[model samples]
Target: MLLEDHQLQSIQWTELSRGISFGVDGGCLVEAVERLGLVDIVTVSIVPGGQIVLEAPLGNAAAYWHPCFDPGDSLPADWAGRERFSAVRSAPIGVLVDANGQSSFAFSFDCLTQEGEIEFGASEEAKTFVVRLAITDGLAAARSTVRLAVVAPELAHEQAVRELSVLLHDGIAGRQASEIAREPVYSSWYAYSQQISHDVIMRNASVASGIGCKSVFLDDGWQKFGDGRWYAGCGDWVPDTAKFPDLRGTVAELNAAGLQAVMWIAPFLIGEQSAAYSGLARYATHYSEHLRTWVLDPRHREVREHLVAVCTRLMRDYALDGLKIDFLNDVMNYAGTPSTGDVPDVGDAMTLVLSEIAQALESVRPGSLIEFRQPYISPAVAPFADVIRANDCPADADQNRRSTLNLRLLAISQVVHSDPIMWDPSAPVEAVSRQLLNVFFSVPQISMPLDVLPEAHRARAAELLTQWRALRDVLLGGELSVGLPNEGYPVVSSRLGSTLVVAAYQPRLLDLDLEGVSELVILNSTASSALPYTVFGDVPPVGSALAEGETAARVVEFAERGFVEVPAWGITRITLGA
Candidate 1:
């Protein structure tokens, strides 16, 4: 059993105990990805002793089976009596060996790992591969790094957050950040260039003084989305020279407002149409004949140094506090160059890229925030990450709620987590809006066009945030108890310190009976419903089951443990003071 820990350095993996050496450098996998629930790293070296048993932690039982996809193998004429698992899609998983300038290797996984040949090459080491795996029952799980160092951190604050989360699980309320030293925890805004104006950023900061907008984020669009395309042209990392000429001035305004400035930086790109693509072309890995976008060759030292320099310049130029790394995943999916290139772990090249990004970013700003949006990457890579973006898009509250719940399920395994229930600037607040409200009890994020919100709604939002911050300690440091209750309705409840926050919804009283709830709050994550419940344990200060005394439920004896109902989709807070 050969095991390796990928840090910020590369350690050549040679089978010494077994006594086998392939010259000085015997091809080794450097990184891996922990996507879905399957771990994809090179446990088995290509030379020999490469087969490693893919297993989970003790006590957590799981099943494994590989199903391939075919256009027309066989299909039942009817929908009934069909296996749900029968219809699925898959790809190949193999090792890449750089022969001179070209690269290729082969590996396999079948109903059983027998008689499977894998081969892919020429691939300069630029793209990152997605070694898909189905994981079950774990929060914040990290995939194994094959035989190299350089692991990526989701954000700069991950270390502090994960450490604090562990302490929080033990009922301690302590938080650390680069700035605050230690107070008020933290929150970040998703700053979208197309939507957020200086005014919006200021207002969001002002509004957040109450709820929890610790830091303000500036998402993509500073440049252009696609051509001057999709958000991929990260190589041209300066504030889209056209968007905001005075980047320093704009960010300065946020800094003065006491809001930390965080910027969106893909930091790497290769479009022939792009300014640097022609020059970067010499170092890119050729994956497609179309040649629309080229993979960046991190294996090339110049590319690495240029990325570091560019990032440093951006930070210095904008006086920004943090950065959101968009696509380190390019490592695995990319093709590597010859000589100076290192291969990604078995099937996780993204891990290596992420790790490299973390080191480079930290060298510039030790506590830089590195937000990665994929959830599966959260666990296998959270220790190096600050904030994990649960999903790419925040469609609605219910969807967000499911996202939040699924993410929570990952939390027991992930020591660090971000609040879901997001509000993307362009996302309409129709369906899942209520779900976001309910999700506040879990990890919360408000990614909406909050600054330009109607005055009345803004005021209401402001008021709610103020209350949320008051209980920040309780929210971040409480014990979370959850229930699927047969999937009829989804409910997640957290008992933080003296307060208990619960988000519940269902059709015609979904039948939820909390066991040890001291404080009760109803969240409207679904369609509007008439809530029929009251506070169970300690009496609340302001809003309680009695506020709507007549319309809502108010059971005197069992307010503390019985079931309750809400008529609409939204969130209500109930506090319990000792």
Candidate 2:
């Protein structure tokens, strides 16, 4: 739609489906445009080519937005230095915005379960931005589609991103994620990694249950002993009897402890040391030199069948309520064996595999949760995954904050989760509080061994979890508005009904229209003790509570007070007079 004014000499364009199409060597690039108000949603379906380049007038574009795991500001004009790449489990959408956060251009591809590269380079002579979208693994044998949205200059970047999400969601027919997907979890990955025992898990599960976590996100090292081999023992989904002698009993124990059991499985990674690798190596397209594992090509019926059976047996035999499927994006690294599999395209193969697995797991137990991590949270994978999580940032709270907020925006109706929050057992209470506050919007995943943590630290975790549980609706179900993303989102606020909850990662002004809120909660995640604000209406504060339960600093004269100070790294709940 943005190419309406551009003229090309070599290529001839034709009208198709109220849009445009052009020919490539092997096939045609078809763009179907659906206009929603002033926004043009252009779906570009292409048969693999070297790349597809579209030139658009580069007007007033100052900054760019990508679903990045880290925080940073990038200018589209500076694209000559570096190109951005995204996969199923990484940043999958891109947008160029002006200084006021208004989107100039936005685009996202469907079926990016594999890696796709989007390059934004300026055409100095034409005074336009040359947008290039390509499959990094080279031209595919079948058509893959990328949707581009030309948003009005008045629409904010967040709104533009959500528009793309809506287009992708409907085009792919993604489902409304179940409520169970949003429940808080306690994961064993960061705490124990590959080294975990049944006894250790049970101890943690009891403590986790007491701390308001609804599920035990059992991570890797369950299928094999903690030999520190690092995924070398993957591909086999069976639990190591020594570590989990009674795997079924372990699930039952977790259920009895009021925690759902979710196991971790990597179906694509078959370690050289694994028995499955010996039998299934023929189905693999490439051996990952970095992982030292054979990446199975799921296009093959044998590979998909093998993985589905393994996942089904694991869920049925162990009575697992859910699974944390990992390393799926590996399928994008290489094409499947030529002329050997039922599904040809890597994207199609993955979709089929995930669909079959989800169906099979559901047959075993109703409402079975399927969790996929970042980059993989695209529309194509949305129908299958119940929860989409931030990538592994471990102890980085700010990174988790950025990652989760980005996820929340792109994953519209689906459940988004943070990487399991892990902190030092001796970390200061405020430091621990910051970790919890950072991922306040998404479902919390705590990876600390709660039973082993210091009493004060454990109490803090419990307190925060309690607080989050009480405000889960306002946090997740409410209207989300985030501050400048280029600033790593210094402020994030959600409003539901009459309640407003704002988390300040950096102390700043709260210059907001406070018309609808009867209760305002400000969470101070920064080291600063106070956040400044200006009141707009006639309402005055009637009651106040500090997050740490510290004595009040001072009673503010609302008519003249400019700022309110609370305990550092704590919250202030101001009850407003009606």
Candidate 3:
């Protein structure tokens, strides 16, 4: 309903300089042509009907771009080249909104030919607002297209995202939902990092099972040591017999303890010392001087086969339930020549390789869990993986919340996971609960050594986790509503059937409409001692509050449009009247 008001028109092309031309066809498709070198900026001016705002998901765990620019402001500046810009940090999908926070126009590119930036600013020369799509990394004699859409003003953000998701799913490989994607998983990166060993992993898995985690992701440190660098031991996909004397037994033990075993692997990276590095040198598309590793060229048939074989072996030999494919964004050649001899674009290559790996693993083990992180998170790659996790943002709950919400808005039906949550074990129970509560809507992957956590903290985690498990279905599958941007989602609400759940990050009073909603749960994610809330429909005046560190919910008073003094980082559940 929101996309019918605007019409695509006024198609025109302009030659900005030698060997370069830019134009729009049928009002929605923006095309750029380069004959010899890179074309940086192509500007298009339009008279926006309302307040102008742009929404772009960042490349990684950084902030989402939702800046509301005035008549004179410039778009946010770029961060140099792709190497410095972080991998695949910006998606082609963006929304243009009017003053009423309604979608006016939306845009998405089919593929990323090269690393680029699409920015918007007020153009004094044209006396109108202009959108500029810049290719920071020069493309050699190529053409690119950016698809656009005109939507109705009343279309909500979530609805617009749903439409975008459909477009992406149709364009790329679309993923089917899986149960393991929604289950709670434990990761070893935050707890052990490179210090992981067989015994430590089992101990962590044992505790994870005790606290209701269904899977354990054993992160870096399985292969032979290589110069003390975490990824230096990569590319070999072999279990270091020294640390893991009996890999099969370890997996069996974990499965026996009710925990599925997931291993982390970087398919693109080839350590210098790894034997595979010398044998696969011809397949190297990019070399990272920082990590001193070569990024395997996925476009090469042999390279794809190698990656597939690696994943296949992990699933077949070790009998792993899943694989956390890491560093997928590093497959591109940022420093050297962009493309050579009909090589596919980095984005396309990544999609193909990941698809093959996922297919190979699933063939051996049906419904095998596959995890991928940010930057590689696009509709094209979504179909190849079951779980898309927020990138690493250790101890930063706010970033994790933002990343999860951003991913949810884009992934739609897929399981959007939080960055493995790692916080100071010494923090108060209330503080620790805030970490879990921040990502309440998405599947959570805890990466802390539970056995070593303070008893109070462990108990708090168990209480919050239990409540989360009970509400997992509603929280993960419900219709989601994200409040105004830039305010860090002061209020995020999800609704399913007659149940309504709301989480408040800011201290502002939350005004909720509960028509036909029989049950309501509110989570206070702030540091304040209490959360203030009000319901619009006919509901009970009192509810039950579950304070942090407490196992029981105590009866609490809730007057219509009045504040309920919930504990800091706690929750309250209210029942409604018929």
Per-structure clash totals for the candidates: 96, 6, 8
The digit string of per-residue lDDT tens for model 2 on 244-305 reads 99989989999998989998888899877777778898888587777777888887899989
Full-model lDDT, candidate 1:
0.41
Off by over 4 Å in 2: 1-34, 43-62, 76-92, 109-115, 121-129, 134-141, 144-147, 171-179, 336-339, 535-561
Q: Mind giving the per-residue lDDT tens digits that candidate 1 earns over 50-111?
A: 22221111111111111121112111111111111100012122221121111111122321
How far is 78's C-alpha from truth in model 1 (Å)?
Answer: 20
User: For candidate 3, lDDT tens digit of each residue in 1-578?
Assistant: 01111121232435343222234432323333322121123222222121112222221111123311111221232321111121244355655444333444444444343454454433333322334443332322233333333222336655665666566466555566555778888888888887787899887777788877888888888767622664555678887888888888999999999988888888888877787888887778567877777888776778888899989998999998888888776666642355442444655556667778878988998888888888666665677887888877899887788778878877755688888888887777766788899998899889888878888887777778898988888888889887654455668889999888888888877777777776778888887766666767565445555554567767765467767666667776766541
Candidate ranking (lDDT, best to worst): 2, 3, 1
Model-by-model lDDT, in order?
0.41, 0.73, 0.65
Off by over 4 Å in 3: 1-90, 96-105, 112-116, 122-129, 134-146, 171-173, 334-343, 537-560
Model 2 alpha-carbon miss at residue 288, Å: 0.9
Consecutive 10-residue window with the lowest summed lDDT within model 3 = 1-10
User: Higher-lDDT candidate among 1 and 3?
Assistant: 3
Candidate 3 lDDT: 0.65
Candidate 1 segments exceeding 4 Å error:
1-212, 224-233, 286-292, 335-353, 375-380, 411-435, 441-443, 485-489, 507-517, 524-555, 559-567, 570-578
Which pairs in model 3 have colliding backbones?
Answer: 2-151, 2-152, 3-151, 3-152, 51-98, 51-99, 59-89, 175-383
